[model samples]
Target chain A: MSTILLIEQILNGLQFGVMLFLMAAGLTLIFGVMGLINLAHGSLYMIGAFAAAAVAGWSGNFLLALIASLIAAAIFGVIVEMTVIRRLYKRDHLDQVLATFALILIFSEATRWTFGSFPLFLDIPAVLKGTVILPGGIEYSLYRLTIILIGLAVALGLYLLISKTRVGMRIRAGENDREMIGALGVDISVLYTMVFALGAALAGLSGALVGAIQSVEVGMGEPVLILAFVVIVIGGIGSIRGALAGAILVGLTDTLGRTLLPVLFSSFMDGSAATTVGSALASMLIYILMAGVLIFKPTGLFGSA
Target chain B: MISKNAKRTVKALGAATALALSLGQVAVADGHAGKLKVGMLTTLTGGGAGLGVDIRDGFLLAIEQSGNAGIEVVVEDDQRKPDIAVQVADKMIQSEKVDILTGIVFSNLALAVAPSATAQGKFYISPNAGPAQLAGRGCHENYFNVAWQNDGPHEAAGATANKMGIKKAFIWAPNYPAGQDALTGFKRTFEGEVAQEVFTKLGQTDYAAEIAQMRASDADGIFFFAPGGMGISFLKQYADSGVDLPLVGPAFSFDQTILPAVGAAAEGVLNTAQWAPDLDNDASRAFVESFKEAYGRIPSIYAQQGFDTGLLIASAATKADVKDADAFRAALREADFTSTRGDFKFGNNQHPIQDFWVRKVIQLDDGTFINTAVEVALEDRQDVYATECALDW
Candidate 1:
C-alpha cells in the first residue's frame, strides 16, 4: 500500500475510534460512579435514535431532534433509575447483570412494539451531507467528521463536569466511598440517580449522532454494546480516561487492520489468498489488542493499577 | 327415604344441564367440530420482528379471508433461538396437538424443527428458510417448503447477470451459511472471475472498510446477501460512499422488509426474487391490494411465503382429512395450490420448484417507492447444487 492509502486508513481508524469513545465514555462513567453493570446502556442508545427520528419527523429540524434525544434519554434514565434500578443498589453483580439483562429484553420488545420491526432512517442533516477535503488529499465524509467533533466536545464537557462541578465532587466522593458520602447527609440516592441519568444522556447523545449515519432500529444497541464493553474492559473497569484511550485504540486497530492487512498480505501472496487471510486476521485484531493489553497493563494504560 | 332419592335426582339433572351449556359455547367458539390446528412459529418480538410481524399478518389475513375456516392457527415466538425453536416445535406437536407445523425465517431454526416434525409424521410446512440439504438428499416425505430454497433467488440473479453479459463481479456477504449459499448460487450461472469475495460479520453495521475495498477494486458489479436491518445499514452506507458500481442481491435484502429503511437509497438497486408487490396476475394483485389495505404496508417475500404456507396447509388438510398424518404427508407431496406466484407444485425433494423474477426499484405514483418492472421466470430457476441433494425425488 502507498503512504497516502495507509494515512487514509489511519484516519478511518481514528474516526471509528472516536465513535467508540462516545459510546464507552458513558458506559465507563455509569459503571465507575454507580458501581452498577447496566446492560441496558445500549437500550438507551436505541432510545436516543428513536427520539431523534420521532422529533426530526415531527419538527423537520435536525438540531431539535438531536436536543430531543439527549433530553428524552436522560428522562428515560431517571424513570428507570427511580422505578427499577433503585432497588438493586446493594445487590450482587449477578443480580445487577440479570436485572439489566431483563431491562434489555423489556426495552427491545417495547421499542419494537412501539416502532414496529422496520428500521427508521435518519437523514444526515442537509448541511452536513457532503464530503470534506482533508490533509494528505483525503476526502472524508462530512457527517463522519461532525461525529468526531461532537464526540470531542462531549469528552471535554464530561471531563470538566466530573472535575469542576459540585455534583462532580459528589460523584467522585460517591465513587471512592458510597456509605461515607451517605453518612455525611449528601442524599446519596439522589446523587446516584443523577449520575446514572447523566451517563444515560451521554449514551443517548452518542446514539442520536451515530444513528444519522447508521440505522435506528430495535436491537441497534447490541453491536455497539459489545464494542463498548470491550472498550471499558481494556480501559479499566471504571475509568473515563481509560475508556477514551481504549476506544480509540480499538477503533484504529479495527479499521486500519481491516483495510491494510489484505493489501500488506498481497505483497507476498496471491490476490484471493491475501484477501481471505487478511480479512480473517482483521476481524481478530481487536481481540488480539485486548489480549495484549491484559497481558502487559492488566488494568489498562490510563486506569489505576 | 323416597323424598331423599328425589332430591339426589334433581341435583344430577342440574349438573348435567350446566355441562351441556359450556360444551355448546366451546363448540360455537370453535365454529366447527373438526377444528384444524395450525401452529405458527415466528420471531414475534426481537431484531427479526419486522419481517416476522409481516409474515404473521399475512398468514392471519389468509386465515381471515378463508372465513377463519378449517384452520385454528396458534402463533408463538421462536425468539430467533434454535433451542427455543425446538421447544416451541415440541409444544406445538405434543401440547397444542397441531395438525400442521409451519413458519420459520432462518434456515438454522428450520433445520432444528424439521427432523422432529418428520419423526413425528406431522406435515412441516416451511414458510421460509429453504436450506439446500433438505432440497436434495436430506428431504423428507413430511417436510414441505412453501418457500423456495435460499439459493433459488440468487440463481435467478446469476442467470440475469449472465444474460446481461456482466464479466467481472465481486461478492460481499455476511460470514454465515446463507451468505455462502448466495455466493455459490450466483457463481453457478455467472461464468466470470470473482473480483473480490468479502465475508462480513452477521449484523455488521459499519461497511466503510468493505466499501473502500470494493471502490479500490473497481469491479463492474457487486452482489450482497445481507437481510433485514443489515441490508438497510449497508445500502445507506453504500449510498453515502458514492460507489458507482451496480448492486444486486436476493429478495431478503431489497424487498418490502428493508424498503422503508433504505428509502431513497434503494432506488435503482436490482434484486432477484420470487414474489413482488407488482406481479401481473389477478391472484397476486388481489393478495397485494388486500395486504396493503389491511397492514398499511407492502407484503414482503417472507409474508408471501408465510401466506402460501398457510394456504398449502389448508389445502393439504382438506385433501388428507388432517386427522391422518400419513394422508397429509401424501397430500403435501401432491402439493396443489394457487400460490400468489401463480401455479405452484413441489419438486420430488418436497421443496417448491417455482419461478424466479428479476426486479428493479422505482417510485410509484403514490410518491412511495416499490419494486416495479419485474422480469418474469428468468432462466427457469432451480437450485444449482440440487445434484448434491440426494433427495428421494
Candidate 2:
C-alpha cells in the first residue's frame, strides 16, 4: 500500500500493457487491413519465442536470438499468408476463424513436437538481468523497463510507418477498399503478404521479449492472445492507436486490480479471505473493462463505427 | 544432452499427437488370467501432460526393469477433467477389466475415480494426488497412496521453516482448492508471524506485483506452491526482481521436471519432498540411475511415485494370488517393498508413513538442475488425519 510499491505496480502494469500491444497491434492490423480473423497470431508469437530460445541456446547471443525471432515469425507469417490466409480473406470470418484455429492446433503440436513439453530456458541478457532504481526511488526490473521502452518505440515507429511511408498509405488505402487498390495497379496480394509479415514480426518480437521473463513453452501465447484481443476490442479493432491505448489500459487495470484489491478488501475483511476474493475478482477485471467499453462504444475507443 | 532422455518421452508425445493429444500411448493388448491388469488413467494432454507422461514413463520403466510379465498396464489419459477421469475409470474397470487402478496425477480426478473404483472392488494404487479426504475420514481400505498425502509436502515445509529460523514469512499460491489446502497446511505447523499471504489467479504467469510487495514488506522468507508452468514464471521473475528472501516450498515447483526451465534462478532454494534424486539407498540409487539412462532426464518425484507404485504392485503380485482377494489385500498392506523413499510403511489409512526430506535446488556441473537431499526435515512423519479415518481393518 506504500506509494513506492504502488509506483512499481503501475510500472509493472505498463510493461504488461506494452507486451499486450505488441500482440494486439499485429492482430488489429491484420483484421483492419485484410478483415481476416487470425487466431493463429498467437502461434506466430509462440514460433518467435521458440526461434529465439533455439538461437539463443545455439549461439549464446540474445541479440541474434531476438533477430531470429523477428525473421522467423515474418517468414512463417508470409508463408502462412500465401499458403492459407490468402484464401480465407475472400471467405467469411467463420471460415477464417476455423482455419486459423486449426493453425493454432498445428503450431502448438508442431512446437511441442520440436521443443518437447518441458519449458525452455530463456533469460534476460546479463546487462539487463536485474532491477534498476527509478527516479522515484522505486526498484524495478531493468528488463521490464527495457520492454516498456521497446514497446513505446514500436508504437511511435508504427505511427511514422503508417502516416509518413508510401507502404503505410497503401495499407491504409487497402483497408478502405481492397478491390480499388487492386484495380489501381497495386498488387493487393503482395501488400497483404507484407502486412501480414509485419504483423507476425511484431507478435514474434513481443513473444521473444516476454519469453525471456516468462516461460518459453507451448500454449504460452493463448492467454496473452485473449488479453490482446481484449486490448484491440477496447481500443478499437483495426486501429493501432486503439490497440496501444487498449493494451495499456487493460494492463494497468489488470495489474493494479490484482495488487490493490486484496489490500482494499483487507481493510474490511480478513487477510486470507480478502486475498481469495480479491484475486478471483482481479482475474475478471479486464473482461469487466472490456464489457464496460463495448457497452458504451461498441466500436471501441479507436475503432471506426 | 537435455534431449537424449527426451527422445523416449518424445516418442510417447508423438504417440499422443495423433489422438487429439488427449489419450496416452495405449499398450499392446495381451490379457492373461493370472497376471495383474493395472489401469493407469492419467492426464496426457493439455497443460498437465508433463506430470502424467512422467508417471506413465516411470511406471512402464519399472515394469520393464522388473521384467515382470506378470503385470500388464493399460494407460489412458483422463485429460485432467473429473468427468473424463470418471468415464475412463469406468471403461478400465468394465471393459478393460483392469484388476488394479492407478496413475492419476490430480486429486479431483482421484476423488472422482477412487471411490467408485474401490467400491467396485478394484484396487487403486495411487502414484500421485493423495487428497486429504482419501487419507482422512473418507479413507477407503482398498485405496493405497504410495505418494504422500496432499498436505505432506506443505506440512513438512512448515516444519522446515521453523528449523531454518524464518521468523516472518510471505506466502503465495494460486486461488484454487489445492492452493487453499497448501496455506492451511503450512500455517498448521508454522510458528511465525505472517507478514503477508497472497493468492494469485490460477494459471497466472507474472508475479512482479507480488515480488514488489514481498520486497517492501517486512518478511524474512517466501513460501509458494505454484506447479508446472506458473512456478517457472514466478521463479525467473523472483530472481530478477533482486529480492534476497530465502524461499521454502513443496517440490512440485522445484522438481527435475521444471528446474531446467527455472535455471540458476532456483539455485539454493529449499523445497520439501518425500524423496530426492540423491537419496542414499539401493532402490533409490538404482531407480535414479536407470531412470536417467532410460529417459535421459532426472526423474522428478512424480516419476518416483510411479516407480514406487510399480514396485508395490510387483511385490504384492509375487506374494499372494490376485484371485485370492483377501490374501492379496493383506499382502499389499504388508508394504514389504524396499521403497525409493527410505523407511516406508503405510499408516492405518493406507497412506505412506515415511520420512520427508528437505531438498535444495542445485545446478549440477553438467548444467542440468536437480533437487539434492539437504537434510531430513521430518522423520517417520505420519499425517495427523489417520486418527480420523474410521475404516476398520
Q: For each candidate, C-alpha RMSD in Å?
A: 11.9, 6.8
DockQ of each: 0.17, 0.36
- Top candidate by lDDT: 2
Binned by DockQ into CAPRI classes (incorrect, acceptable, medium, high), candidate 2 is acceptable
- A1-305: candidate 1 lDDT, tens digit per residue: 55655665666677788888877887778777776777788889999999998898888899999999999999999999999888886765556666777787788868867887788878778888767778877666787778888888878888898899998899888878788888999998888888888888888888888787777888788778878877887887678888988988999889888877877898899875676678788888998998898789766666654
lDDT measured at residue B19 in model 2 versus the true structure, 0 to 100: 27
Report how closely model 1 matches the true complex, as a DockQ value: 0.17
Interface RMSD of each: 20.9, 12.2
In the range A1-305, model 2's lDDT, one tens digit per residue, is: 78999999999999999999999999989988887778788889999999999999999899999999999999999999999999997675666766777888788878878888778988889999898898988898999999999999999999999999999999999988878889999998889999999999999999999899888887787777777777887897789999999999999999999999988999999888899999999999998998899789877898676
- Which segments of model 1 are wrong by more than 4 Å? A1-5, A183-185, A257-292, A295-298, B1-35, B163-165
lDDT of 1 by residue, B289-326 (tens): 89889988888888888788767766666787777766
What's chain A's TM-score in each predicted model? Answer: 0.96, 0.99
